[model samples]
Target chain A: MQTVSIDVGDDGTLSAVLRGELDFTQAARIVAAMEAAIDDCRPDSVRVDLAEVTFLDSSGIGALVRAMKAADQVNASFVVERPTLVVFDQLNTAGLVDVFGLRRA
Target chain B: MIPETDSGYLQRLAELEARVDQARLSPEILSERAAGLLAGRIGCRIDEAHAHLRLLAGQQNTSVASVAATVIGALEIRRSTSLRQVRHSVEEALRATDQEPDQPVRVSAPDASYSWLDVVQQMLNALPGKHIVVVPVRGDDGRITDYECVAVSPGMRDLSGRTGPQLIGMAISTAYPDIVGGPVWRAWADSLTDGHPRSVEPFTYVHIDNGDASEHLLTVRVRPVGPGLLNSWVMHDEQTRLAERIDQTERLGNLGYGEWDLITDTTVWSDGLYRIYERDPADGPLPRAESEALGLPEDEPLRRQAAEEFGRGETIDLTTRALINGKVKHLRAVIDTVRDAEGRPRKVYGIIQDVTARETSRRKLAEVERQLHEHQQDLAAEHRLAAQLQHIVLPIPETPVDLPGLRAAVRYLPAEQASRIGGDWFHAALAGDGSVVLAVGDVAGHGVQAAATMAQLRHTMAALTMTTTSQPAELLAHLNRLLLALGVSTAPATAVIVRWEPATHACTWSQAGHPPPLHARAGVAVELPRPAGPLLGGLAHAEYGTNSLDLAAGDILLLYTDGLVEHRERTLSEGTAPVADLMSRVTAERRDYPLDVLLAGLQRANPDDDTCLLAVRRTDCGNGHD
Candidate 1:
């Protein structure tokens, strides 16, 4: 029931803003949404805005790994943009914050 | 032995014989006691109860048990819980809808050891005009509490001749206040508690008809059904038989018959309708709006749909839920309209039924199904994650990895079990001394921990090859000491390393508890002679020695993890035979297929373990695919 908005840049960069919890169920739903955006925009770089994610678990980590892999297959760059402190800590715990290119707001 | 026999020996022999007699009882005695109890309960001869016991055993999916204690858990649960759990009789009764078209309908004796629910359903269908109900009597503190109406037949009416849709959850005390604290209540409660049927003699009871009192003779029958009581009543009079017929039909199906005049907003309800609403006859029927208010807030959309259909004067059938007396009940109703000549609604007639029992059971079944589906999804996710991790860490080379004088190809297969997350790895690289160092190793155990150990060993070994010489024996000896220094005795490893020099066509290899490498030449293949050495991480002081084998042109060498050749039933020699034969055959065939195909064809798919194979061959330069 939370909302996600995506914008595409001329250089094939997809900027997505996500709101609400990224728990297991919501993580699974976003995986499909991200896949659709990637397919439609064919973006070379994806920046995800997780500033509004109040909760995140292993499922969110899995989603990030999957997004990174999908971007790799398409030769695109994947970056985490404007992540909340909780989201940054979660990615760090999974040892993938650097792999996912998390950036400060 | 006979010559040594004495008086004490004889006495000891007698004691031993007595002890044997006191041991376990014979199976036959246990079965007989069980059959006796069953016979008494089922009202059948001992032999028939024994037969029923066997059928009950089969139905419960239990092998078998003794006579007395062999009551199926379902029966015990029904006896102890007052019929809250699913009962054998209930399952059979529910099957009435699926009964064969040709099956004859009959009501058997209550004690016949037959499917009572099936018989009840058939009988209820046969005589829809008859009023019947099964009630559970709960007693505590040495007194009979009120009865809960678990089931009801069509057309059951109260003293006021008003009908209720469902009596399943209604307390008998509320609906039949005249009978509470009376002789009939005592007889029914005692019958249920004692597990015996008792009859009530015909008695005169005063009935109020339209505010007028008259005496009527009533005969009541009560029969025990497990821990519940089944009741049947008859008024010994012919005058109201016509009205009683309609009430009987509605009572059997938990239906309410009612009519509403749209113009006056007046509602006339049968006794069944009052029961559905959990209301008192003294309070007159609820107006249309008050009746609609019984539904939960979420059911407003359904209320709106019904209103729109009514406005259009359309016949409507709706199934919804309502909170009556603070208890949620499923309510289904069918409505038809009498329109004036101008096509405006005039009068509405409806039949309502309560279906909460069926709905509750359905929701429980759905919850169980959802849990099972989620379990399967978790397993699939685990499997996918393991494969993804393997792809990240290993990522086998795309094609032949060209070394000094040899071109090597690798084949890797993961364990088929979804949980097999081990570290099975292989390494091939050119050393500083210009010799190609090839290695294959497996870490003990499985899961993320094993994989981590594997990564540590591989990266450490790769770093060591650059710093140390390409001498197979010296390198293995150092690796063994490192394993001991690391204190990983519990997580041991097996590895085979080969150092090949292109100019001399010579190979020096050392193995640490690994199967010796296989060598194929011309039309034959055989395992290379093994050098002496204990497994690495097995002991601190174990020494390793190198062995040399001359490489010939057109020869293929293979080093593999044990999974490639291990089988539960096959001996080491027997398991390795296929790989040896496959190499010779594939090398002989030459042009028919690629080496990858031959390697794949040679491996038997073993789901229990994983395998990693590195096949290296010295190829003469300037020769392509052929």
Candidate 2:
């Protein structure tokens, strides 16, 4: 599985691109990367670019929920962008699409 | 005047007297001879001839004695007139005698006192060696008035065999009852009156043995000679052979005939019927009720119906199963009624046959059909289980929701085939840093294999999400490489990734051969401008591209797979309009509802896709915090 990548813009906003699948088998790795990106950049808010993530199952949705809770604790704005239909369906089924702010592509 | 016996007259008278002398015959002998002659000529009896002679004499106003005497005179006169003809007839009768006694001779008569019998008998005697004895007789009762002995130079008996009157007055029945009660009697009795003379029909008569254990058969016939009298003859032999032929026909064909008298409740079965039922002839003469007991238990009702229909005067042919000697068999029975002159059933007749083989085969055929039906149902149930397992393994999401900066949502609609659950999926995630990564992809194909592939890809994506925060384009390229590593080179996937920063209001998104997402912001909805790339798992080094969008405060981002925008018969752009309209509503309504409500509302509005929507508002700290 591919690891997560975060690119911080000059304006101090962070965009984290998630790769490969997001499910129970790799949720821990994605979560750890998320924390590291938040710490390294310490940006004002976070945006996750999922436009390249190929697949998502229920465990992937659960991992995203955990990330959302973590962002809330830090008072940092958290958002999701360009989710594949697969990722959105998982969020849709979990009833958390709006919570992650999945951008359309 | 004295009648002169002239010498010429007297000599003529003398010659006439001598002529009378030469013709002189015993009136009794002549009468007997005449009777014999008439009996043969007219096929009547001797006594009947005597009565006829008397009646003819009375009608002529002459003495019976004179009539008798004139019979020979008249015969002589006839002989003289047709000597050649007489000789021819006499010779023919003589030749007939040489031919055989059984060979009959016919003689014609001239209405005279002495009939053709006299001529026939004369002809019989004239053939040198033949003799038929005749005794002179006279009867006062007109039967036999007189008897005397007379000698002719060429004497012969009138018929062959036993002679004389010793066998007279014998009752015919003492010999042949068949002759007494049948046609002979009618012929003989009719001869006693002024009836036409006839010969009795020939029939065999049986003479009982002295011990009464055996009998002899004879063919006897009688003919009326004259009024009230007849001559009869009997021949023996040829009747045993005829009776044997009738018995042979009865045995073949296993044929039996029977009749039941309804009123008397008496049943009669033929010999064949008893044999078929394996019953002794003496045992049966049973009633219809008893005969019914011969059928098996199951066949009793059918037997009863047959009997009832016969009682109702109907002809019924019924088949039923029976058991004989502990083995079941099928029997076809026919019962018919014999009605009296009144249109009511008087007797019933029945016949039976066997048909077990046909019935057995039919039952076996039905059993096979039932088994085949059950086997088909079993196969159908197995298919249903397969479909159910596919659904549980890869489920479709029903609603949309929000994550964070990226306005992302997805839809996973199962395919329409009731037996198939398709492989379409969408994923949305908020990583640990308040950053959101979302993806929607369609695994190649449908059903169980597709679902299993989806599970693998989905877990792989989540794992990578935490490992690195790569750009969306690089993320897809990496996933493609990972798929190739996992031996899924044949399974392709299309996905889009969107990452958003709430504070900067910027969204970076990439597409890997997935449908572009539609963005609704500032009251307008359009598919976001984005770079395109090949689907994952297609090539070893397939690349991807990303584009950035500045998302304003209440922007709604909708992400989905081709299933939402592509139908086989329609263009993808046709499907985009609806998603766009719903996106516009969500963006417009974002300020009035919470993130969850807004997501739910957008999903409800776009129920066609396995829709996933993520709506996030840019929150300001001051007003809400106070």
Candidate 3:
């Protein structure tokens, strides 16, 4: 599988491009790498892009939620952008949509 | 024998005699005194006179000397005193008689009594009513019962013309047999059998229409007096009365009502509600904390719901499972919130009911639903497995084969329902000798086991027929053996096999407890003959009979599993007739249609079951067709 990538803008806004599946196998690595970069770069706001995400699960949502909370601890803004309908519905039902500032495409 | 002495001596003698009469001295003391006195007077031995005197004293109530003195000296004085006392009593009585001349006086006597009858008669005659008549009933067994009859003051006998024979000597039961046969009589009889009284006050008495019947629709009061004598009295034109109110206080008070104040954190419970909660209502209302604590731990969600309703100022009617007295109960409560003018919650009121029985029934219903769901799931899983097994056992042939004179196509339609997916199979394989071996079989039931049996039978038939020349009878016999053996040891299968020979232009077929295939030629269809045999596996020693048909060129033969033509709701003949009609129509319309197309058409013909059609046609050599 190809590695998913993340980019940070000059204005301290971070963006992640997720590819393949955000299933169990990839959620942990994505969360860890994005979190480490957020800590090092000290971005003011972060957005995770899920346009490339083929599959998403409860674990994926948990990783995102954890990352959001971790960002909050550091006083950085957190958001998820362009999640699929299925993932969005699951997160909405589980009451994690507002916590992560999730939005549908 | 008079004592000639002074009056004082005489008085002293009298005092001594009175003392002797009053005291209970022993016989010896009497003898001692008598000896002293009579020692000189009586010349015989004093002991003999003393014995005789003691015997006499014992008979009388005084000492022997006192008796002797009374007989000799005091007798005259006692008679005189008695005479004087009698004269004084007579004088008093005469004076009372002078005051009331009609009064009678009698001399009193002891040790005797008047009879009960006399006393009862006196009591009855002394009452102030002149119209009272008392009749005493005497049973043959010597049991006496009394009844009173009161006539209308002057005796209405003149108006009635008839005498009182009907009123007297008649048992109440005999007079009113309807009353005796009614439920009241049975109840009264039970009470009386327990030796208690049952009274019917102001009941209507229907007097038989007799000449001059003045008492004809009288109100009668009845009471059982003694054994079999029912006291019945007739009242003229009495107003009837009845109880006005019925008792239902217990039913109304059974369930309790309650209210909870969220703002004040207070709860008010009715007496019955407290009792329902198994708490004493006398001890104020239960603290809200304690009341919630007493509920089952599992009911915390319901408590939260009730709290939410109170917050929203909404009424909540809910039922929850509770534990009361260490036993699980279903409690039903209808809760309503009283709201303030600003739409704020004031208090939550509810009616709490113990619905343990209803909850138990609901639990049982849920349990039954769960069981039914589990059973359905199990059956569906079994069906899936069976379908898979059937797929593995009798897989569809990838290609059609060229038999000597017949071109054959076979299709197998599985059950429509997911839970009925099972052993329905069709086989069309070319024999080693260039003959066609076609077979279709259905195992009885629909499930994993049936599918497995179908697979086994189909595989065994293929293997057995491979070793022998393709003879329909021989192949069926082998299939029958396998089926019978498997059935005896396990589940069995039903099948039909067709063998076609191009050289002879004839088709030989045998049936083993399977529906016969349809033979259609020139748009005319008929069921092929079935061989004689019992269903495979039903009997240990059984063989299927064979049937044959000569194939004319352009003729079509159809073989199928019975699922295509049998349904649970319809008989075999009913299901087969429709399929046969469809086959006739389809072939007549398009005899030249491809085998696959024909099979698809047949599937369309019956949509309920998985349908299979094996259509075979022998090419005709006439008119240079071949």
| Candidate with best lDDT | 1
Over 4 Å off in model 3, which ranges?
A1-105, B1-254, B257-293, B297-322, B330-352, B355-383, B397-400, B415-418, B432-434, B487-492, B501-506, B520-526, B563-593, B603-609, B619-626
Looking at model 1, residue A54 earns an lDDT score of 61
| Candidate 2 Cα errors over 4 Å, as ranges | A1-105, B1-417, B432-434, B468-470, B481-491, B501-506, B589-626
- Write one digit per residue (lDDT tens) for candidate 2, span B205-242: 44445445334443323323322233434333333464
All candidates: DockQ: 0.01, 0.01, 0.01
Residue B202 C-alpha lDDT in model 1: 84
Task: Please tell me what DockQ candidate 2 reaches.
Answer: 0.01
Sequence-dependent TM-score of model 1:
0.42
Model 2, global lDDT: 0.55
Comparing 2 and 3 on lDDT, the stronger one: 3
Off by over 4 Å in 1: A1-105, B1-291, B310-315, B323-330, B335-389, B413-423, B432-435, B443-457, B468-494, B501-513, B529-555, B585-601, B605-610, B618-626
Q: What's the true lDDT of residue B139 in model 1?
A: 76
Interface RMSD (Å), each candidate? 19.7, 14.5, 26.0
Name the 10 consecutive residues with the lowest summed lDDT in model 1 chain B: B15-24
Clashes of 1: 23
